[model samples]
Target: MNNNTPNNNLTIESLWQFSLQYYSMREIKEACLNLQNHFHGNVNLLLALKWLDEHRLTFPSSQWPQVIQSLGRTEALLLHFRELRRKSKQHLPESLYRDSLQFELQLERQQQADIIDIIHRIELSKVEAPHLVDDYCHQLGAEHLAVIFNKQRL
Candidate 1:
């Protein structure tokens, strides 16, 4: 468990790209949203965990507080915009809703960038993918997501 020198292959852009592809799958998207809605899980963190797992990297439990703190403001904004979008669905015109969704996605991308910055600063260990994903999802009290995430691993 080194405290520095993450794998050279693990770039923020790569993680973002991986997230975009993985989250595009219908099952993965639904599971991620379910974890967010039901377990108060951060979708970006969830995807980050999966991304780390795919790369056989460990996101130490000790780093979670830092990650959470870094994401606080953006997460709040994402939730706020998401709530507004959901609440306004019936009242807002289709084009407005689409714009709102796109804005929310922008916030989501920012959140992912924030997560990636923290990742770049932290120490990551190399370990089995399942263990990382399982441990993380278990900590989130969303073990079911571990299954889905593992099954859908690219």
Candidate 2:
């Protein structure tokens, strides 16, 4: 039902306008909630609370945190989700790459499954020695996967 009646304090138009005006998604939702409470009988605002989050939201890098938090939505939908998308590859699984890269780069024992996987993908015959690892790195550079071998000196 619509709440464009004379006494209604909130409207769909205002909600959209509020988002444009504020850097914080939380602030926008807070403002909407306050107006909803002030009027107490507006079904339009109530309906909005259900669907405002289903849509995708991206923001300027400067406003991302506020845009994310103020929107009163899950980070998976509007925030960190982009990182998930960026790390995805058509030929490789995202979770496997992130987990393997993290484990492979960590400072620990000389062995890890991640290291083995990296070696296997690059081919042992192509790289012949420890010093040649840098050459292997150059080859892997094309894939933007060189960050995996940092091995963290510290």
Candidate 3:
């Protein structure tokens, strides 16, 4: 949906816009890039976790694997875009490389939207407030996943 469209309540588009805005913050961008490069973190999932944490909602422990499974091909899509972008930088003219960079970014945005669609399908299981972020990481299969969200110190 166009982000300009009005909604009575928060929707995936809002969350996606929040992700775009929040992830653009210098600190968050650096941290997210570190997580992506060093720890195989999915930035989209991290943004959704932040949104869910803010709203005081979480998936049940039983459903963590479901969340990971629902990520579908986001990782693969990112890999594809990254490869294309990298190759374009090496082989294409500066103008084409710049255009490829923009297209790659758009692909990344669409990938985020796809992940949000999966997240919207989940049934909210409310939980204790402060623990939601950690809970999300644990569900992702490591206590350290929370480090990316900064719910715990490394």
Candidate 4:
């Protein structure tokens, strides 16, 4: 299929701009590399080639700022998880829950504390909840049905 249109003044700049709409930095970089093999003097190609590290599997150089911010946030969230796990090991003091079932329930609640609030406020009418659950399960590979089931029970 001849993709080129006569009305369009097709150039590297136009293609680059159009590509930016749908292609990620990595995809753009790959396209740039292919373009470089055939054409020269395209700064976008140069940026794409040099933006990547030696492995060709690292982050885009342009996203370093957001990546750094996300890394910091992730580190803090991980620390929170670690401390929460430690707290779980030590136990939250049985005095907090008089009944054993209460303790079990509380533990389950704590396990999902991060997402519980969001789940509670979720409106089933506004969105398809099952799809979200499916996507989450897909991301985790194997998910514990008990977690979502328990949350639904609440």
Highest TM-score among the candidates is held by which one? 1
Higher-TM-score candidate among 1 and 4? 1
Look at candidate 1 and tell me the lDDT of residue 133: 65
CA lDDT of every candidate: 0.81, 0.30, 0.66, 0.32
Candidate 2, clashing residue pairs?
Answer: 25-70, 25-71, 26-70, 26-71
Q: TM-scores of the models, in the given order?
A: 0.89, 0.18, 0.74, 0.22
In the range 1-154, model 1's lDDT, one tens digit per residue, is 2555455666677877898899999999999889889988888888887888777787677877887787886977788879979998999999999998889878888888888778777777777434766876788788978888898878
Find the 10 residues in a row with the least total lDDT in model 3: 1-10
- RMSD of every candidate to native, in Å, equals 2.1, 27.4, 5.5, 22.3
Looking at model 2, residue 128 earns an lDDT score of 22
Question: What pairs collide in candidate 3?
Answer: none
Q: What are the per-residue Cα lDDT tens digits for candidate 2 across 15-102?
A: 4443334314454445334433443322122222222221211112343233223333332242244345446645567787676555
Q: What is candidate 4's lDDT per residue for 1-154, written digit by digit as tens?
A: 0222121323334333433432344544454444333332222322221211111223223433432232242344444554565566547565543354454434333323322222222221222232332232333342343133213210
Candidate whose lDDT is highest: 1
- Give the range of the ten consecutive residues with the poorest summed lDDT in model 2: 50-59
Kindly provide the TM-score of model 2 when superposed on the true structure, using C-alpha atoms: 0.18
Give the clash count for model 1. 0
Ranking by lDDT: 1, 3, 4, 2
Q: List where candidate 1 sits over 4 angstroms from the true fold.
A: 1-8
Q: Give me the displacement of residue 153 in model 4, in angstroms.
A: 3.5
Question: What shift in Å separates residue 67 of candidate 3 from its native position after superposition?
Answer: 1.4
